[model samples]
Target: MPTNGGQIKTYAAPEGVAVADAFLIYARSVDSEPWIPVSTYAVDVAEVNTTRNEFDKHPISVASFDMDGPVEVQVKYTLNKVQSAAIRPKSLGIQAVIDGDNTITFSLDRPRDVMLEINHDKWQALHILTNGIDHNALPSDSQETWYFGPGINNGSPYGLVTDGNLFVPSNTMVYLAGGAFVTFKLNFIKVCNSGVRGHGFIYNGPNGGAILIERSENIVVENVTSLGATGFSLTTGEAKGVTISGYRSFSSHGNGDGVDLFCSSDILVENCFLRNSDDTIAIYGHRWDYYGDSSNIVIRNCTLLPDIAHPIHMGTHGNPAKPETISGIHISNIDILDHYENQMWYQGCISLSAGDENLIEDVHIQDVRVERISKGQLVNMRVMKNEMWTTAPGHGIRNVTLKNISLDATNSQIVNPSQILGFDYTRKVENIVFENLNIGGQYIHDGMGKPRWYMVADLVPMFINEHVTNVKFILTK
Candidate 1:
């Protein structure tokens, strides 16, 4: 759909792909132009921990496109059924021009991923994913690039025999062009200076990870969309010097983490959108054959929506005998859309539940906006032994700082308080600070006007359990 100054490109799903009838979507460059029909695909959501009930499935919709610039959009839902409509983060302040009770119109200037809800329905919202044109996409005829053009591409030519897995060798660049649907586990093992880029979708359904990087360095996976993976979508274990930018992932199956790193270091994950049934991004010390400390990771400018678990979870798995350390993590400029978890112990948007004799320290989270928390806590920093996932208690969680963290609970529900606890006297959580923590338009600090006997957590409504020391909230402008 090309206009005078702006253009839009849409991808058709493969044959046998399911299309959604819940909404009709269209796009145009301006108000005077004719609207082009956008393909709306049905994606599974809330299908974990259950028997795939239709009522509980939700059957979310996604409309994606590549745009050159700003564009106008419209969405039409069931007539007279929608009493309300909203688009979030809520910080974006994207107002919809409601046309009666069934249609809404909006404008998008920048490429972003947004959720559109009807009648305040949280589970069955439509995701509008807009991406810019891939200017650095390699040509199809390049010798260094192995290109998969538009269509359903299996891994027959790339050594996919019986396992439904495709291994990309070292020093190679694999490009999945627009409208290409790849159906295999793309693995990069022991490779250097390799990458997989372009505007394509990797659909590895009900199997292992969508893209796995193990024992590899100097690798990048950018601007690629992955959906319907049963395990982690994009994972790195025992790998280093990796960058994942402009990536998108969606999953509904059990243990469907967005970007999980185990025993890895020096990673940068930015400008990504992840909506999953488990943690959106988890950083751990050691797991499986990946044995070492996880350090120097930066995750910024990403949107995370966790339907069943935490958004940013870390320090849960490590070596119990050697006592590994997970340190030097910085997470900033994040927009957490929604977090819903029923289990009390496993419900936090930012959780650092250290276990398996791991020592987690020197972590910082700043400039984050949390829009909705349906049934979870804002933060959970604990060092305890959980028999379900860990064998021993952690050493401690220390030297953590959170700055300019804001949560908007005006139109949402928060059922639990944030927790900070430690295991015993020997293992304590210390040196924690919260600067400019805002909740419901109020900054929670130490000098707030409250009763003299009230602690700082009383204002923020947090729980400072035993063995936690040196926790302070400062009013930093």
Candidate 2:
């Protein structure tokens, strides 16, 4: 294990509540200076029934650090009164050992962010980041490259303004140096072959979103730490060939989705950390001017903590008149830390609610380890109509597969099981398969019971309405 001193910092919890002093470690690259972790306050957000409410006091601590290449780091934490401990995305193979001082040490490879949990579940989360970046060397001044060095320098039509927000044009590059603290959003509108990247911070005020890529193509946003977007952290609408990597975001506002894709195609989102109040990654069909089906989208190797909503949501919004279809989606190797929602119809860690006459199919969700479902279900696949959003019900949902999904509901009071339902006989869901689906170390198969039809106030374990057909479950020993 790499031993570095004082790189970690601890934040105190509430006045009376007992919490652990979390530690973070970072590996120094010979090519660059030592990485300084960003410390943010995490609040205990209560579940609201209708509208967005104010957050509780900042009782939890979150730390993030960046590193290049591969390295091993150890996180040491004060062991609280606990029964079990786990590092999220167990595929990372993090090893924990209790030191003689009664502290726990976690060892893992770098270039990823993981949530450290004590006992079976608690609210105090230590978000460790091992970020990787390219092109760290400063860029030379050129017509194609727009550089913003230390301090504020406004390049009227090209670079940031006095308030630090910049509207990037097409065929350009915007770079912010290290230690640069800029407070503005980056807007890429109808641009092509452009990128906004840096080690600097992008602070979105409490009104608009941070980054907007509308009707753009070949756009890239990487290695940026974004905080406090009233809207989405990154919103891509009617865009194509968009790639978002090595990004970290935190949103505490209502409807502040991490990455909302509307009618976008050929997208790849990987190696990111998102702690949002809404859906972390929402893939929707046509809406407003963005009118088309979304395809070939892949989101993997990420850590998602939806403090208020779903981690992966799809097919919620679409044009009822046009009726588009969303297909060819793959989500793998994800760690869902915590999902909180009170609305049963909109409660899930992974939800595919095909609404507004859309046909959502060909989805593959594999190797997902959900640490805790605080208030929602494991998986919810439904085809229905949202009276507030959709004009008509969805067409159907078919050929969706869930494999190697494990949920730890040990300390959860709401053990809401998964559901796969269709609207009616005319618009149904079919060809759904589950392989090695284990909840609290128990395999869910056909041997559980008959299909439990859901009603308004009924609380069932697992539901498969009659309208859902061709459901297969292959249990693993």
Candidate 3:
């Protein structure tokens, strides 16, 4: 384990592989963390572009490498104690082929969502024993894919196969042609291990999902666990270094959006936990082969629950132009719990609409704790109707900062903007701040559906708007 600046590798496996016992894989990050794990390294991968080695001196996203390029950087998997037969009966075995230029890095801390779905050979995998069990009577077994640990010999487990199972005959057999559904070029990660021991149920279903890092990336999914799905999607494109943290992107689908900062960037998602149905933590500006933006972000000590949508959503979808580029973003200590349906269609807990004006300056939502908002807006700086595409998230919601927030609404009401709903709305919303915040609620009226914004101290539509500019609010207690 070289020191000076970078180099730490340790893996032990021989204590248990389940009933058949024996496993160990060490280097648990070097004990007390959040820091203290970095050494020097930079053997010259393409002249060391973007400070590749030596762990960038500090916030280099953890997993670093770049010395004269590829050489089987590393790939590992050791399931200490799991296998319990009943793995069906494709053949009861293991095989290998051997090839290089492979780089696999995985790190999940746990909370839910833990999958490794892989089945190859034109979508082949059926050792189905149904339960009673007997993939060939155990004892060590063998099958269509099985490359035992330590050094791994012979075949090496038929290309690759995870958790297992994929047999299609009528379900559109691999799109009805020669068909095939197993070919990973490498770089894949889905870790949600919130402190381990199945904190929530990372993967608890008959059909589970985890290795869905969309396209792929030079990956690192930190302290992970998803407890749900539809969120926790990393997506891949040119594929750059990635780092996500203390995961818990809980979902029920139907727009379940959480921890989805699409396209991909020099990324990093800090301490997380989002329970969503739509927008618990969103950052988009691109689509398809995965574009980019949602920019260099850092979301801190979090806990945003949207059960439906909008706990923190900032998208600049301007049809998909490089996916609306950005500069930077940092949202600190959060604790929002918003409810959705912000009128017409989408809702908000913290929003900034679509793109074009570009330049969504360094954003921040400090020490936040927004609560109880039902089917409507809370902080939506809108101008939307689909302008050019999106990522504009600007129209005046500039140099933003909503610190020490705590908006309430036991059940509903925080409404007030009506009258001039939509018209060209060129947009320019402006330098905003809502310090030591504390609003009671009731002010909605976009067009008479007004239930409340709980207004008592002046509410001229939450302070009118002519594209609104240089705004301020500092209510407390």
TM-score leader:
1
Could you give me the TM-score of model 3 versus the true structure? 0.29
Cα lDDT listed for each candidate: 0.84, 0.71, 0.39
Off-target runs (Cα >4 Å) in candidate 2 are: 1-53, 57-62, 68-86, 96-108, 117-123, 133-136, 149-165, 446-460, 475-477
Best by lDDT: 1
Give the per-residue lDDT of model 3 (tens digit) for 1-477.
212112232112112211111111111232322222212111100011133432111110012211111111112213222222111111112221122322122232211111111121101111000011112221221332122222111123323443332221111101100001121111243222111111111222123333244443445554333433432422333334456665554445444466666645666667565554566667665555555555667777766656555677765553333335444677786756445453443555677664544435567777665545545655665545553454333332356776765556563555533211211345555666666555554322223233477432234234335665565655443
Candidate 2 lDDT by residue in tens digits, 1-477: 112323322222223222225543333343334543333334332234464455532334454444444444444444355345577666578776655543455544456677666665545556655444433545445687777543333233334453545778889877754333355778788899998776555655434677889889999887776666777889899999999987777766778788999999999998888888789999999777888999999998888888788999999799988899999999998888777777788888889999999999999999888876778888899999988878889999999999988887684557576788899998999998888887778777755554476331132356888899897777665
What are the TM-scores, per candidate, against the unseen true structure?
0.94, 0.81, 0.29
lDDT score for candidate 1 against the true structure: 0.84
What lDDT does candidate 1 reach at residue 61? 84
Which lDDT tens digits does candidate 1 get at residues 61-87? 887777877888899985347777888
Q: What is the TM-score ranking, best to worst?
A: 1, 2, 3
Model 1 residue 247 lDDT?
Answer: 86
Error of 1 at 256 (Å): 1.0
